[model samples]
Target: MLQILNEEGEVVNEKAMPDLSDDELKELMRRMVYTRIWDQRALSLNRQGRLGFYAPVAGQEASMLASEFAMEDEDWLLPSYRDIPQLVFHGLPLTKAFLYSRGHFMGGQIPEGVNALMPQIIIAAQCTQCAGIALGLKKRGKKNVAFTYFGDGATSQGDFYEGLNFAGAYQAPAVFISQNNRFAISVPVEKQTASKTLAQKSVAAGIRGIQVDGMDPLAVYAATKEARENAVNGEGPTLIETLTYRYGPHTTAGDDPTRYRTEELDNEWEKKDPLIRFRKFLENKGLWSKEEEEKTVEQAKDDIKAALKEADNTPKQKVTDLIKIMSETLPYNLQEQLEEYTEKESK
Candidate 1:
């Protein structure tokens, strides 16, 4: 496994560290703090029955943010539902995230200039889509690359293989990141695959493969930076398996993790929490301080509140708009249904 920082928050590989400016480090930390606040606020909204459903991104901060930090604004980002932080990092507004979880129709719209798709709700669906997007970029001779995020369980899906296989054969400019959080809801990683490492799955596709400590932002940043460079240079796709953990239930809906794993196990991972280690690293560099962290926390809270208020202000989802976004010119039969639903709901 590639590890740049040890569990005790010490850098063990300065030679392999990512070339991140001090300002970028602070930005990365701010994004992680912002994500945590969003997760907590989302839970509160869900419990109050104000939001439909949500998947928390609390524990996978380094796994999500650092890799995305490697991408350019022109690159394409494909994501699963829990990848809201990366999507927001790519250009989606914080308020749009709340709108999305609340099921507002406009939430699905990608903001202009953000080269990303709406978060895929299906497992591993974005993997194949990412490959296709990358292939398109290659055919068009674009300098941009494509990146997608999936989980450990998704490795079991057919889309994962199909995407990788095609990307390899065509030498597409793509990066596949699998955040192996150790569980596919209830099924443990040991039971999910017999392979020694998820990254090795790329061997069948003839691409670069790497396994890294997902809890280490520096490591993820370095690995993804290398992968992105390889892709834009026509070296082909890379499969990166990030060994990480999720601290919360799969979704905010009714699910009990205690029935599947031990609280002691979760506590163990907490000691290596991404934020704590990265915070310590920045503090030691005199780039971060205790008071600075508190200010970040307060700023996150206020921003989250404003986002929630914006979501609350959005017009409720309409039957017409939902159907129309699916097509510019509605099909003949569906047009009637849309009219009926809109008439009924509008009343």
Candidate 2:
């Protein structure tokens, strides 16, 4: 129910909004624009056969950007494959993100000082990992909290319930963020569950549940900030359902959304695009202008181009490197198989 800006981008409730400085507001807008540009470039790269695959965070930029900004530096982030924006917002380098998209093993390495896990491809697996990380931090007497990102469809998985239950029972410091994009690939929310709202599912887990207008950056930031504070205070886990949407197909080289969604729906959602909406709000505050917007977009595009070029220029991963980095001591059968493959390749 908390809203700072209305659909038209007018400040409807400024009194309840955070007193974000002009510079911070502009930075948020810039990041959202950058994320949009990066997503488009990645999708195009996938289409041109340059990258393996991509998940476009076209409409959910505000949700990711704001939630990430709400976290402390030492907080842990357990993200899914579709959370590239969240990672990027947390200062993850664009070059490394490009490396990840290009399937480089080096991309899996977490940068120093970043408490982020490699993006999990398996659906809902990061939830359990987040819970475990929170428990470990608690036992060590660390004040850091874990923030886990997943989709609404993942709520149906057993891991989701188990993770929340365990976090609550042990009073682990964690926050579960469900990006309820209204669809799990081709399956709609109605087909996934009869629960009136995804937030309601958290009730039985003995955690605080809240829903937010994900398109509004302020709302996402406020909710996450509150949840994060609770976790650090040992109030246990909180579940946040971010009501957002993916404006494009689930992923590049994946299913077609046109077959399931009409152009009308897409257009309607486009009207509510988070980047555009937030920009309008900034403009209304006399903090943003068309010229500044153009500059930001151009800079973001240049950065993406540079990242793609860097990704392309990186040395191709040697097949042997995979085997070398495997288990320290391979099993007898696997070692034999690896030796045979190496011998054949040497020919």
Candidate 3:
């Protein structure tokens, strides 16, 4: 239960604050603002059929930003599809992100030195992959750690247990971050697990586990930074359960929450929005002004609009190109089939 800011956004743990310069804090706030704007715009795009399905990180901005900021450049990140903000914070281009949303195959081909994996849609798959990567790094005597992100529901999958157990047993350099947003597609966390907390589950796997206040960015950063340090220092893996909430649907094209949840509860969560909480924290420090806040949000909106336009202008991919991209050396039978298809098309 680590926390820096309380529910009212007052500094409750001054010692936990990062040694950040005013410029850095301002920049972080800018990124948060931009990320929120991008998320909303993407959701709108999906609704308008301009893009494919999207997972909104509307209520979890602090959790994403802090965890991302805690990582090193050389470290690897295995993120679930919902972690768009984490990818953006790690220097992924906005154009590529939009391209991915538009269903482009090459959009996820991350550039070198980025050390981020493609977003995994299969639940809990990236956890095992991260464990393997961390194990390999450990064998190679590398200092880098691997951080894998997943939701609360993913913990029920076999891969989650297998990955965590193996990482602990072999002393793999990895961190497992469980962003417990309470609902796994309408299934509450309590119904998903009998355990009192997700972090407690890690104890059975023989790893250090901590439950952090996810809405508090500084708390998340402190927890992840410590976990990362322990991994790099040969102390093996750690599990961090970030208690947070999602204020939107599971994905843009998913079922409406009103079918399963109360609008009153939704409104309550809205009042506890991480962005607003952090904004108040900054204001209390005299680090944010009303005019500056307006200007920041306006700039973010402009940037997002520009990025969306760029995504729209990009050349559309041909449906036939999928087959061409799939094979390097086509078998004789496949070659004959392709030739027959091409001949029929020419007719």
Candidate 4:
């Protein structure tokens, strides 16, 4: 496995560490800390019925954020349902994220210039979409790559192989990241596939692949940076499998992880928590302090509070609004439906 920092956050492989400046390293830690705060708050909001349909993203911070940190703004991102952080970082607003969780139709609409799709709830759907976007970028002679994220269970789907094979055949500039967080809902990764490593599955599609220590932000950053470079250089796509674990239940949607996972297993992965590991590494370099962490925590809380407020204030979407947004000029059927709903709502 590719590893730069061990469980204790000590550099285990100096040669493999990315050449990140002190500020950049600290920023990475800050983002992870902020994301942790957001995850915690989101879960509480979900429990209080203030938000709808949330997927907890506690422990896979390094895998998700570090990979996104490696990408440029011009690159397109196709994210899974659990990848709200990547979308927000890639230019989607936090308010929109909250609206999305609340099932607002506007949440699906990407703002002009934000090179991303809405969080895809369907399994592995983004993989195929990412491949198509990458191919389009190549044909347009753009240097940007299309990056995507999926879970280990997504690899078991036919769309996963089809997407990779299409990208390989066309040599599309795409980087596929598999955040293998040990379980797909209540199902374990082992039952999803027999492949020794999810990364190796890329061989069948004639692309390069690597497995990285997902809990190690430095390792994930280095690998994703290299993969992005390779893609933009016309070396075809790359599949990266980040071996990580999610600390919370799969989602806030009636999932009881305790039913499928053990306390012992959870404790084992807790020792490798990305936030703690990265915090130690930053402190060792005198880049992070409790003061900074506390500030970040407060900032994250304030941001979430404001974003949720914005979402709450947005006008509730109506059936007519959904019908109208479907097209510029609605079809006869939709037009009739829209009028029907509009009149009914007026009552």
TM-score of each: 0.97, 0.95, 0.93, 0.99
Could you give candidate 1's per-residue lDDT for residues 1-347 as a string of tens digits? 99998877789998998888999999888888778877887888899998877987778999999999999999999999899889988999988988888788678889999999998989999999999999999999999999999999999999999999999999999999999999868899999899999999999999999999999999999999999999999999999999998888888878788889898999999998999989888888889887877888899899888888888888877777778777888898789889899799877
For candidate 3, write residues 1-347 as lDDT tens digits: 88987878888898877666777676667777777877888888887898885889888887888888888888998999999778877877777788887778666868878898989999999989999999999999999999999999999999999999999999999999999988878898889889999999898889999999888887888899889999999999999999888888888766687787788888877777777888888888888888877887898788777877887888776534555566898777767777776676667
Point to the candidate with the largest TM-score. 4
Pairs of colliding residues, candidate 4: none
Error of 3 at 272 (Å): 2.1
In candidate 2, position 136 carries an lDDT of: 96
Tell me model 2's lDDT, rounded to 2 decimals: 0.86
Q: State candidate 3's TM-score.
A: 0.93
Kindly give the stretch of ten consecutive residues in candidate 2 with the minimal lDDT sum: 317-326
After the best TM-score superposition of candidate 4, give how far the Cα of residue 136 lies from its true spot, in angstroms.
Answer: 0.6
TM-score of 2: 0.95
Model 4 misplaced regions, further than 4 Å? none
Candidate 1 lands at a TM-score of 0.97
Q: What is the lDDT of residue 153 in candidate 1?
A: 95
Estimate, for each residue in 1-347, the C-alpha lDDT of model 2 and write its tens digit. 55677778887776768757899889888888878877887888888888886888999998888889888888999999999788766667777888888788877777898889989998888989999999999999999899999999899999999999999999999999999988879888989899999888889999999988888898888889889899999999999999888998898866799887788878887887888888888888899998988898899989888877887888887666667668798888768878887887789
Residues 230-294, candidate 4: write the lDDT tens digits.
99999999999999999998888789999999999999999999999999888898899999999
Candidate 4 residue-wise lDDT at 45: 90
- The order of the candidates by TM-score, greatest first, is 4, 1, 2, 3
